[model samples]
Target: MVNYASGEAKGELSGAEYRRYSRHLLLPGFTPESQRKLRSAKVAVVGAGGLGSPILQYLAAAGVGSLTVIDADLVDSSNLQRQVIHSEAAVGTPKVASAAHAVHALNQAVHVREVPEVLTPANALATLAGHDLVLDGTDNFPTRYLVSDACEILNVPLIWGSILAFDGQVAVFFGDEGRGVTYRDVHPRPPEPGEVPSCSEAGVLGPLVGVIGSTMAMEALKVLTGLGSPLYGRIQLYSALTGDWTRLDVARRAGRAPVTEIEDLVETCGFPAVEASGAAPVRAEVLSPAEALREAATGRLLIDIREESEAAEGMLPHAVNIPKTQLMEFARGERAGVGPLSEVGDLHGAILHCAGGARSAAAQAELAALGISVANMAGGYVASVTLRP
Candidate 1:
């Protein structure tokens, strides 16, 4: 076992490590011993986009003994805006590979493990085990819950951070059974599917993730080296627009049961229904991008279900902007005169799209529930524009 108290361990730092970490060695609270503890620590960072970028950079720079970066995504041009660990040249490369490159560039003394697979409930334990702590920078709710549940089961601390738009949140969950609070205590139930737009949909400021990711890295160091009262049992909220920071105390729910095992998070989280085989069967009526463009050229209404901010980036020309949320409300007839639905006169046979196909698919389901049939643009705007014929 690594001794965090004195930072000295079987994996003692070399002369180069000493010189490289001289500043950390000199900090009053973070002594040379703490630096050694960092050198002996092993951490797993989930997700290599946005928040994960800074968390990985700082942790590797801090000389954490080993870092296992897990992410299934490939870097996209859009990711360069905030996912700073990846470079322009790395745009089509696996995010975990790009992250490993960045980590090694920062500190060759630290070991890097790249896992280019998605973290699913089935593989959560195996993927997250052996790490002293887990840092969660995942953007979706299901993965967040999975990380928390896995940490709870493994009896490890989770350094969690989330950022959307100008707002960000950080928290630390630790301890077992009666003592510590898990993420469920903070949010007993996941938000309704599509209730909140992801960073991809709503868009986030580039600097906003940097601020939150750095904060998460700081908390991770605190947890690993016992530097201070790690944000365990507390939630920190930051709003870049207002330049304000607030902390809230979180306690384990009085009667809430502890998470004993992981569950089917997709079903539990109320995600849209899919085929039992875990693949969404292609709906024959779904229009190909070329077909949609042809229809649009003939004055067919193409509704962009992405958030207005997402649409502003660039959307299918001639598509009307009716955000998914407003479109759902309009489909329910709960909000009249709120979207292009009013202009559609009849909701039947409307065409819808989002950044990707998911939201548009959900919108299609919503309108279908209201007895309206809409053709979803396959692959949404991305494919529509990229595959323009």
Candidate 2:
């Protein structure tokens, strides 16, 4: 039998640690044995933005022995609204570096390893190889799909979360290894281009992120130490304004593969055309980065998904504050902070940008789910700025 306990049942924690996690040790399901399992387990979190911030902090504070955090971007002013791991002082630092510092600050006993580079398909399998369970805190579809496929290949469970304006969703995918499904099993396709709005195109509720991200942290703990029933294969959805949380059941397909577009995304992760089982994709009206800069009134919502600090560093004149990590949930649940949002508002075209293309393109697909037509800024925010500069 695979022991959830790490064979250190009797004297796992010292007096200080026992006091710190006294309540946990006393919980019906969480004994010293389970706590030892937590100390033995290692978790890898793929992003350190809105969702990642809560996942990392709580896991560290709760004493997950070691954590591996990977993120290629930098901290910016825009990130301050939802990404809690970073402070205003750390705005300019790389996300992984700042996040690692924050984790260590919370609990030096918990180890945090920072991978400043973005997780790509090439390195994903190796990156996720050793962790007991990997947390899905990535911001975009390509990365999400990449992580899901990699986890499935590695036989690891993924604790996933996504957030937008006022709503978010969390679930445990591939938790049972031989039986469960992946992110692909749930959404299937990335979506047609220009179908959704990037956070920059729309605004988000700051605290909404905290609610979902912290829940992701909670889910990770449940899966790691065998504390309770995991949210395996079922998505827990949340809405802040109504404070309604709903659960969507997910089960593996009997025999056929769950996703149809799996073969197409194996190459670049971008699909100009995508068709999935769930819903029709929204179409986006757009200008290439070149055209948008020259004309400036393409009518496309130009979204800058970089952190706020990065935005202060500079941004497109009409850009907004939704980060890419929040893209999927935002597209589904967001309301404009300064104006009324309607079904038509969800269908508007947009140009999504990040420091580069990675996050923006991913955000574009999630918006497609919300009925917006979207496209990625070709060279990304850097390219957009360079063209207009």
Candidate 3:
């Protein structure tokens, strides 16, 4: 026998809360009772970037009792486009700190626990346990699988969302192995490494993330307040170009094994094995950005391994624009006629760079496998520009 009408789950709201959530309190179906449910809810949000930005903002504003923000990444200038919780001054700050600051500003009554560490298989369960629900905003596959698995073991609902380019998808998974669907029901296996391009590689529209993130927050509110049917067995897809939304139903796979415990997700997802059994570690020759610039100035070959559009923004004056795709093709000896690599003879001792250092590092590995010695510019173009002064 629970009395919800008085809105006293944790305790009665203060006069300030009544004013702050007055609109919600006035809704016909939703009374202050629902607001109390929201006030008693505890949510864990993974990845305090893009989708996490909106999810955290709205939930804190809606007065979620507590939020655990988990992320290891630091704020960068690029994130400001859609990670609206952070400011220009917050760049180089840990994302969780910036996100917690924003949450406090929005609602001081909401408690925030900022864990500035990457969620790994070793700690996923410990980090995510005890929360009423988990919202996933991470951009990669392995972490997604890890979070979903951890939720399954914890028997918590997962509010999941993803955005790439102009396309976004949102879904709710209850992670109850037999009764309802989980992320594994939707994506039984993770995509192979390199099969899917990251937002950094493919580029994403900033506003698209806001739409998906806000939708995710709305879904979380519904689940927390028991207001309406949640998207437990459905996935919603949005196309900004077409301005249409489509919903598809998903179900738990029959006889799908329950997730008993978390395992090494990186290995399970088939990411490149970090160190093979007893094999010598292969390290690429690295060059400081300053040294790479000097080499480029002296007319040494410098290959910009980013895509054509990225190179057009600003590239080293003497750098050749051989995109990562073309470079990989050349590494595989599948050179096309009139390929960009053909414009420069002998890539044996060239330097490679990208907007950041990741693409260049991947490209360097591919070239190294073909016995082509190339030096990767540490920190890539970003560091190069910083060192210019």
- Local distance difference test values of all predictions, in order: 0.80, 0.71, 0.81
Q: Residue 389 lDDT in model 3?
A: 38
TM-score of each: 0.79, 0.70, 0.79
Local accuracy of candidate 2 as per-residue lDDT tens digits, 1-389: 01122222234577777888888887887887777778777899989988889889999888788788888777877789888889999867788888888877777777677788867767887878899999987656677888887888788889888876677889999735556778877876675333444454445688877898889889888888877888987999998889999989987766644332223252334444432236663333334577655434645466677767777877776666566555554456644332222444643555667765556655665555555666666546654533453
TM accuracy, model 3: 0.79
lDDT of model 1 at residue 245? 97
What lDDT does model 3 reach? 0.81
lDDT: worst 10-residue window of model 1: 1-10
Candidate 1 C-alpha error for residue 225, in Å:
0.7
**lDDT tens per residue, model 1, 34-140:** 88788888899999999999999999888787888899777877788899999989977888888888887777767788889989989999999999999999988
CA error at residue 107 for candidate 2, angstroms: 0.3
RMSD of each: 6.6, 10.0, 6.4
lDDT (0-100) at residue 113 of candidate 1? 83
Q: How far does residue 50 in candidate 1 sit from its true spot (Å)?
A: 0.9
Task: Report the candidate with higher TM-score, 2 versus 3.
Answer: 3
Candidate 3 wrongly placed segments (more than 4 Å): 1-9, 268-270, 274-304, 312-321, 332-389
Leading candidate by lDDT = 3
